[model samples]
Target: MDPYGDTLFNEQAAQVACQEIAALTLRCADDQRKAALLDLAELLEACETTPGSDVLLMGD
Candidate 1:
């Protein structure tokens, strides 16, 4: 994971990322953070099931 560059996760990594995001979503106390995590988790899940799909994280 690079903080100064973009990160891309393929199907296999998306599955793991989605699960971790879901777990974090459950433990998050802030509603906004939870919502954002949920949205990310949803995207990761979609990427996980779609062939050749990936989740990209752009860093600032």
Candidate 2:
């Protein structure tokens, strides 16, 4: 696979990881939300490394 393919996989994995982390965070205390948010941030960083012609920073 190419670098772009790898990046896509990484980004999807990061998103799934963040979703799982967020679900777990909801079961924990307020402090746990911070850690979950951190995980989501890391996922965003990974997603940023992916190159594409139609990149989105937000949805309408």
lDDT of each: 0.88, 0.56
Q: Can you give the TM-score per candidate against the true fold?
A: 0.85, 0.40
Q: How many clashing pairs in candidate 1?
A: 0
Worst 10 residues of 1 by lDDT: 17-26
Reference-based lDDT, residue 52, model 1: 95
Q: List candidate 2 segments past 4 Å from native.
A: 1-9, 30-60
Q: After superposition, how far is residue 5 of candidate 1 from its true place, in Å?
A: 2.2
lDDT of 1 by residue, 1-60 (tens): 576898899999998888788778778999999999888888888998899998888886
Name the top TM-score candidate. Answer: 1
Give the C-alpha miss distance for residue 32 in model 2, angstroms: 5.7
> Clashing residue pairs, candidate 2?
none
Deviation from truth (RMSD, Å), model 1: 2.0
